[model samples]
Target chain A: MTAEEWEDFRKGHPKAASLKTVPLPFPELCATLFDGNAATGNPSQCLKLQHSAVIRIQTSRTLEEPKEDNMAKFSIATVFIASISLLLTLTHSFSLENPTDRRILVLVDDLALKSSHSIFFSSLQARGFELDFKLSDDPKIALQRYGQHLYDGLILFSPSTERFGGSLDVAAILDFVDSGKDLIVAADANASDLIRNIAAECGIDFDEDPSAVVIDHGSYAVSETEGDHTLIAADDFIQSDVLLGSTKIEAPVLFKGIGHSLNPANSLVLKVLSGSPSAYSANPKSKLSSPPSLSGSSISLVSVVQARNNARIVFSGSLDLFSNKFFKSTVQKAGSSHKFAKSGNQQFATEISKWVFHERGHLKAVNVRHHRVGETDEPAIYRINDDLEYLVEIYEWSGSNWEPYVANDVQVQFYMMSPYVLKTMSNNKKGLYLASFKVPDVYGVFQFKVEYQRLGYTSLSLAKQIPVRPFRHNEYERFIPTAFPYYGASFSTMAGFLIFSFVYLYSK
Target chain B: MGRSPTTKDDAQALFQSLRSAYAATPTNLKIIDLYVVFAVSTAVIQVVYMAIVGSFPFNSFLSGVLSCVGTAVLAVCLRIQVNKENKEFKDLPPERAFADFVLCNLVLHLVIMNFLG
Candidate 1:
């Protein structure tokens, strides 16, 4: 009997089995002991015991005996399950290439959003993220459970949901980002205070007017009949391929929503797209009363913020920015004859999604080393005026792999209170940067700093503390040419005293 | 005319007494004074030489003049101790003072030799 047959027999009985002997042909006895007569009392217990012994014997020899097909099948099944579990663990570990974010908790107004924004949802899904979608009113919506973070990213697409029904609120949302989670917020014309509060935490202010929509008179998309020019066709996007997409946006993006202003105090927030000079935020159906609070080019159509904690947030006024309709719409400026078959919304949304998800703008610095030009080991301390070389390699993550980050302005500042020596590092195309400089004459605690912040690239701020010491007395040169006159005078006086004393004494 | 003759006679008498007192000075003391004059003159000559040719080797010039001055000073002490008319150094022997002066002169020259050039 095989181990499986014995286990089946053991489960069939209620009491524990004992180790005993059975008499029959090896296969017959093994099969009979497990599935023998349903004997009651001591006899059944004895039979159960015999079955357990036989099962143990069979399993002990299962690996050695290839003839047992059942045992082989059971072992194969265990191996398959173990391997599958190991593969799952490895997949989860490699999911978040950048530690800034990994798992995302996507809260929506309903489960229907999972399919409505399938294009955006699937893009994140393909990137090895575990997205848990819950209705905004679900009592179980939690950013953390038992002090451990439940998610690393959040998407606020439920613009109209009054209040998150669980422990989640405006404060909780801010805490999630403060702990370093990437966020993408798409606000409509009537976005709730919950969303506006969240946007404020990210240093952006949406128009306070509840009914105002982004209205552009000059750049409205030309439709069949002349209608309200509330629908804008904007293409004056930021000219950064890294921030937007590598491909130029040919078609104008159709936007129908409110406008926002980035906080003047927050330097990290940037306006990616601006409204035209004629555009203003006001009630489209009502008569003009007071001056609109947000108007003209001051209205930022799209804004992005990189928090001090390195958390990324993207705020766009229109929730339809990611909708299939805007992605597929054709656009023709009101006064222009050119008509593009598609809008820039799809490409803009996709590329911006990739950036918010950390598929780009990820930087890693490694192999920081400094030594004498040809030496391998770093010295404990640098000598003043010594010629030394410093090398640091930098690479940027491009969704799949690390590629060399090439730039001419990457500099190394040998700093104390101020930069004593600032040198631009030279790099090979492969990302290996090298810089050589003589240590400054001043000696004290100094730092080698690389403060690299460029548009569209994640800022790389690296500072390594090092001590530079003055040369030891013995280390100084024994003879100096400029000071020879001083030395000569010191010795010549001694010689003159000897000659004058001899002459004076002899004359006396 | 009588007043003019009397004034001339008084001046001549004073000169006569001064000459008689100078003739009483000891030969060794006169020799020491001559040596001091010679040392002073040599220092002055060196100073004039420095003024004409610049103090390029100023330390050498200092030690040269100082050595001459030290020798003359030691010689004057010896002359003062040996003088028969002097009472302050009556207990000090002329031979002992001379030996002391020679030893001090040797030490001074050794220091001067080390200091000069």
Candidate 2:
């Protein structure tokens, strides 16, 4: 009987039939036998057995009669399911093209803040981030599960929390950043010591006084009731199109919070937004008793740090900058005549978030290659004064896909002790950068180096070592036309010697 | 001021004395002097050529001019040593001096040929 008929008969009379009564179909029998032999000591031996069983099944199928259409449909359905599952597993892993953080954990002081900051959270969600919200003091809160990090980014919004619950602590957060994850911390007036320590670790120091808030008299926002001049309308943003987006911020950002200064010794931290020259950080409720510790343009309202491992962190002095209320608030600078219907808080926060999440300004270089002119194969060592071409393809990760990274200032250096040849590479509109130059006359070990460090983008440093050799003895040109006069002079001297010898001997 | 002869008369007298003195030299020494003059004139011609046409092939220019100058210097040394009246080289034979000059010329020409390119 055909395999299909046997399968139907066995299903219809399961109680009457036994394994001894009927021989099973080849595939089903092999599957059962392989499962019975699962206790094999070596995994490789078990695999061999399974492979042999599959081959036996194929041969048995050829010997048996043809099956019904239902059997083909069943096998096709199983294959389709298996391929879909394989595809799903492949997409779960991290990929180079989509480098933006996927999952983020947001810690807040209370669950009510979730609703208060729903706008920012929704923006992140709209950009395909899976945000996990939890209270800072929750006992079950953990940054990691088992041995793996549960999230690719972290958001600390609980500025007032003195301590965290569970195993989470300052060291744990630093370790998270050390592993190249991103972070965003927002602080306000009376920021807890714990939050201050975190900011200090990132090379920023908040004002010493707990009551100190940023006070800007010259650029304060005009309000219905004039209070402590603490409601700052700050337009002094860092002039970077990559960090702040291409569109100019039309209205001043409304900031009402404390201010901090970047550490002088730390080069990684940068102030994204600064206070006006007249601004100072002091307690506005009390009279001015002494000069404020952080004042003027040095008082940074928003700062960012890019670690050596390329982990990004954004520190904002005020959590209200990201609040729904400030996002909807209208404002006018005290000295300016234009009254913007809405503050620039929404655009500013969104753009900065985009930078911290690595949706912009992430660059990667690939396919670095060098070869002699008019040749396709790369030589082991280059001859001195040989003409060669160097090429590299650079692409920027644009959140969802890798796009061509085009810039005019990228340069390649042929370096040994110092730069022998530094050439600015020309690029095709599609992101292939190339430079052609003759090797220097001197021969030594050399390196092809591209050290690209722009303002907002992650640094791209690539160096490839190559040796350069002097020309061989036979490689020199023999009969040069320019040297004909010298040859003639040398040969004429020899001729003159012969003639002089003959004359001197004959005359004597 | 001291009633010195005119510049033209002085030049003529100097040339006459030099010619008479050179006439006393040996014939072989005179031949060496002629060879020296030829080498020096060739060197001068090459310098003038290098000036008009730029010295682009600098090694060639150097080799050409140096070879001629070297030949002239060697010939002059041979002439000084072979002069029979010179007491300083009375111990050295003229045949030996000529052999030394020939050997030095060969070495100079070999180096010049290598450097010409």
Candidate 3:
């Protein structure tokens, strides 16, 4: 049996997992016990199963088990039952510490999206994610069952869904993100209030006009016929290698959707795809009597937010951006003769989804250690001027494994009420960051702090408290050469007093 | 023109009379006067030395200067009490004043020695 199959069996029958180490010589005997026959102490049942096993082994002697249907079934069942009795263990459900999202729940407005956006879904599936598809109004759907999250991430493709069924609501979804789960939301021109509210909570404000669609006459895609200029060939993507893969996306992504304005107060939100300078959002059918609310390069085509909990969310202005039509379509920007053989939408969607799902840019810091110079063991309290070394190992999740995150700007701060020493750490190219500094002369409770916040990477905020003490009484210098004159003068004064008193009394 | 000669003669006369008056002072009182001058000069010398060299050992510097000043002041008190011309302390014996000065000097020297380091 494969590891995944063994894991599934172990999860399904935890009671039998403990008995796995006790080698089951008779598979038929264990099958009876596992099938709710523990109370039935019948010896004849085991004998009957043993008789069946002998017949199967004799028929499958040539090892061509696939040719015999009954033999294959019996042999596979025996292997599964044997593996199921072997181990009981605990597993994480896509934790941030693990930084790998294994399961996802995709909610759609229509079931036809399973066929329309099959490419994007298939890419996630190919990456080993178990995606559960459900209609937006499916009453039996739930994010968590028995207080345990059923999915590690949520993908909202239902731009027109006004109310989600079951226990999931605006607050429930927000709560899910607060607990460090990932989310991906796609909105169309007729985005309902529910979808808009979710986007607004993520620091993205969709155009207030419900019918408004992003219309760009300057940089619209070059179509065969003169259209309403809603199909935009946007190319302004955020310059980040960690969010977007290292290989550059050469073509402009095709977007046919509404536009949004990121909240200025929200510092965590980033504009992944921005509208062109001439792009504006309004009802394309009506006359432009007033200026559009969101226009110019400020209009965001796609945005992403990384919460303080490290949960990631991506908001796209168009749901059709993930459709097969856009993924397979060729793109040509207006006034540009050069045409891209394929749209950049597929690469853009794949890379950005990798980021939102924590496959990239996820960082973990461990084994934080500090000790006095020339000493291997850490002291409880540091002397005022003792030199010390601060070390921390930081690694980035590379989808399949942790890799060394090499950056020249990682820093460590020796902080009390304020930073006393702020030094940039030097990495050994093996993920170990080192910074050595002398303890400040001032004595108080101090902390070794590392507040690393970089663009497109999970922020690392670590603070380890330490105490600093002044020198002991015996630690002071016994004698100083500089104070010799004062010492001589004082002693001379004592001698002079004794001599003058004797002289005065004897002579007079 | 004759006024210059008169001025020079007047200054000479003043000096002669001051010398005559000081010569009448008792030998013990004169010795105390010399002691006060010696103590005062020593303190001045130490202060000048402190200025030349930085006052790194501040407590030692203070004790050194205070010891000299205390000795000078006690000597002056003894001189005052022993002077028969000064009647304010006539009832107090000169020996008693001498004993008091000795005891005070001993205490001052002990404190200065302790503070020198």
Best by DockQ, which number?
A: 2
Error of 1 at A394 (Å): 0.6
- lDDT string, candidate 3, A419-504, tens digits: 99999999999999999999999999999999989988999999999999997746654356766655665666667667766777
On DockQ, who's better, 1 or 2?
Answer: 2
Candidate 1, residues B1-117, lDDT tens digits: the string is: 879999999999999998798678765566666666666666666667668777665656666677767766776777778787789989988768767876887787777655555
True-vs-predicted CA distance for residue B98, candidate 3, Å: 9.5
User: Comparing 1 and 3 by lDDT, which wins?
Assistant: 3
- Cα deviation at A47, candidate 1, in Å, is 44
lDDT of all predictions: 0.78, 0.88, 0.87
Model 2, runs deviating above 4 Å: A1-96, A132-151, A163-179, A216-235, A248-252, A264-267, A276-279, A295-297, A328-343, A370-390, A412-424, A435-449, A464-483, B1-21, B76-100
Ranking by lDDT: 2, 3, 1
DockQ of each: 0.04, 0.44, 0.25
Model 2 chain B lDDT-worst window of ten: B1-10
Candidate 3 collision pairs: A20-A85, A20-A86
Reference-based TM-score, model 2: 0.73
Question: Which lDDT value does model 2 have at A50?
Answer: 45
Q: Write the per-residue lDDT of candidate 1 for residues A347-436, one digit (tens) a residue.
A: 888888777777787777888989977788998899899899999999988877788988889999999999999999999989999899
